[model samples]
Target chain A: MTTESVRVAVAQTVPEFGAVDRNRRRTLEIVRKNADADLVVLPELATTGYVFESESELADLAEPRDGETASAWAEAAAETGTWIVGGVAERAGASYYNSALVVSPDGLEGVYRKVHPWNEEKRWFAAGSDLPVFETPFGRLGVQICNDQWFPEATITQARAGADLIAVPTNWVPNPDGDGRPGDWTAGVHQAVAHADANRVWIACADRAGTERGTAFEGQSVVVAPDGVPAAGPAPADGEHVLAVDCDLARARDKSLTPRDDALADRRPEVYDLG
Target chain B: MTTESVRVAVAQTVPEFGAVDRNRRRTLEIVRKNADADLVVLPELATTGYVFESESELADLAEPRDGETASAWAEAAAETGTWIVGGVAERAGASYYNSALVVSPDGLEGVYRKVHPWNEEKRWFAAGSDLPVFETPFGRLGVQICNDQWFPEATITQARAGADLIAVPTNWVPNPDGDGRPGDWTAGVHQAVAHADANRVWIACADRAGTERGTAFEGQSVVVAPDGVPAAGPAPADGEHVLAVDCDLARARDKSLTPRDDALADRRPEVYDLG
Candidate 1:
């Protein structure tokens, strides 16, 4: 494995419901601005905001894997010689899935569907059947969207599959009491830190900001190091911002939390019995 | 299914290496001091201490599940009408296992061996082959030791098995770069919060303090509510302390994060592909 550092960026943006063009443009702008970074991540459903009024409304906003948003993101990635992971509302024939696309300079790298739909999403999107990790020049990458973060298995599966970095495209909503405690971090941010620490992989969470319909998205996007500490921005909780940090991909490959213990290698799945 | 609250106490104490008597007495003192609490959690290997120099040293300190430590803690639990979960280095037949015992007013309720032994532990202890959750007066209780907290499957399995509360008997060591970030809390604490939030289960972690054989234990014992916020002291980072909080076990039963979403029911195990 190569011991090289890769620049990673997490862009927190706000999108208007049903305003596909504006949302796509906003994400494109963030990518262009953070061109120096090797990878840039955008929030869940960036091109089509969450809080769909109906299945028809969601269907109207959804696109295929090779649709407009993917083409635009691919073009931008090619222009900047960077990789982008962004969320989209995907239409696969009659079913719609909340998905994220991994676009490198070459083109579309992979597509990851939301494995577990959250709340109202159950009504509009079909749950994904698989978790796939993609290969990149810097390292193996895994992409999971939004509510998928709630499942530890999502991160664990990816990390176990040799993913060095997991980019999360999330539209974080507030917790019942509040987003998080002792600081500005949302519960989602803490989850990212825990996932990074537990799996020995870098986790970059790009969360959306501002209110869409009646739902107010939390904007505290964060980039967590393999050591579980926040290496960059949890940005402001309710504003658009960009956070970039240099991550050593090799640290993820060496799952050793210490000389004798490895994070992934140490798992006792025989005892897990995950029923 | 009870909606009533359960008073939980996490006692953080310092144990001298090989001073089993003193450590046991200290634990008894803490239990006696917090007699009002319905449940009390103590650190991993609370009586024997960690950092063994050799296999013989570990063997010398190891005890049967019903040995001195368990008997004493059981007596204390009977006297206080409380339930106690504490770690012990177990001598089972010819093998040694890192394990935790659940003692209640009735007697020894259950035992949980650490599934994932960390670092030097692998050299001395036989890995546990199963994960078990005990039926408690307050709720279904799950117990896991130290490094077991690093594995999400530990918590997920117990939660899925109907555990309302998971008591962690941990001797938290400092991470490669300090224990935790953003505050005095350790990475272990972050893991507790994430587990509680993701599984919708109450998590009470009792950790140890002071240094032993060049190894220092982090003393930030924390009790996280089902909402993923610390309800009581992370105690102090380096001192003996007791953290008590009233946890509504019913909230753990109701895994719903939102009206439309239930944390436990939302899991997609089919896609996990843990291997």
Candidate 2:
């Protein structure tokens, strides 16, 4: 394994609902704060926050892929010489999509829409079909938004497509009993770790913190290693933080669990009834 | 969602390497002790033990699906009126397969050969081609062994085939660094939880305890609910313990995470590149 490592950062910020401009500026500020990182990931809906009351409000907040938020993030990425993946509310013709934009130092490299929308998201955003693996200077990067993390297929697709790391931009809500322990590797974190371990790929989740319109967000932004260990923070349950960790792409590329077992190659697809 | 629940028990007993007779007796004893449980699960290769030395040794220890061990288990199940799921090394004619038998009061209901054998198991056991979901009075039961848990498709296939609970008879070897935490929800446990949460199906992992031939096994046998919480478990890392939990098949049946999201229905199979 080569000693090729990259400093990845997850910016756990509190985004106010419907405040697209403010949220965009706040995301840029978070990026600027962690300027030294090779890659920085922001929470889902970083440009417009989550929990909308009306379709009109959602339509008002949603922007195109090349909107002000992406433009500012692209500018910030150019300035810091770091790649960024952050979620946004996208306006495409008559439909809207919950999407994450991959911005490199050059510009907006790619866009990945949320494949599996959660709860109220169904009413607002159209589900995405493509799981893209974007080529980067450090490694091959993949992106998924919030609820998409719940589906193993999303990560499996990207990992098989040759992604060294998958960036998750999430706005994790508390469990029904309000027992979403962000401090511990609870449900959300466990899913991330399992995905990383099963796929033999690194996963970095950047989750938002704070209550927005009666709904509270669980902010345990973490960077998980291929061995299913959290390399970075579980941050705080309800506080904004920048969790950064040095990730070696070589470790992810080497999928061998043992001399005889390679995680991806070992999969018996012929026997698998995936449908 | 029906109000049907089953008491499931995971027997975390240490099986000595190559001690086929003793292992078989120990498994029967564990089952007899947990006779009150509607369903009981035992560790992988509970009859033959793991970490085989030679082909001849494996052949000598391996029995047919209807061999002595299965017969004993069937007798025990008939006596106790408890359904049982336990791993074994099966000798089908000249071929050896790593398999688990589903024994009811009637007899050996079904046999599931481990589809994904771990490490050196490849040399001795031929991987199976099918993922079976067996029918029981309490619920639909599915079986997978140890390393098969590493593949989500194993559980996904069984769940898709209409399994209420997936029984994982595991011989969890410690990580290379000897850091497989049995108390905490580490890699293996996280996988169980994630599988339960993702599929909205119950997962009972019966992992073995103690060292066998210088290779240590992590116990921490667990019963995970559909919401991804450990319903019972994470038994002592190196101790022989029977961890039991009441599992409501109705909870698994109700796949709805929210008012809008149903786990199984939400799966975007059309978009998944699961090749």
**DockQ of all candidate complexes:** 0.69, 0.61
Candidate 2 residues lying further than 4 Å off, grouped into runs, are A1-3, A177-183, B1-3, B177-183
List the global CA lDDT of all models.
0.89, 0.86
Tens-digit lDDT string for candidate 2 (B1-275): 12387899999988888888898889889889988898999989997788898999998888889989879999999999899999998999879999999999999999999999989999998989999899999989999898888899888888888899999999987665323322455467878988988898899999998887888788889888888878887777877899878889988777788899988889888988888
What are the per-residue Cα lDDT tens digits for candidate 1 across A62-111?
99999999999999999998899999999999999999999999999889
Task: Find the 10 residues in a row with the least total lDDT in model 2 chain B.
Answer: B177-186
Residue-level lDDT for B225 in candidate 1: 85
Q: Write the per-residue lDDT of candidate 1 for residues B1-275, one digit (tens) a residue.
A: 13468999999989888999999999999999999999999999999998888999988899999998889998999999999999889999999999998999888887898889988898899988888989887889988888888899999999989999999999998886844476767889999998998998999999999999899888989999888988886788798999988899988999877788888888887888786
What does candidate 1 score on TM? 0.96
Restricting to chain A, the TM-score for each candidate equals: 0.97, 0.96
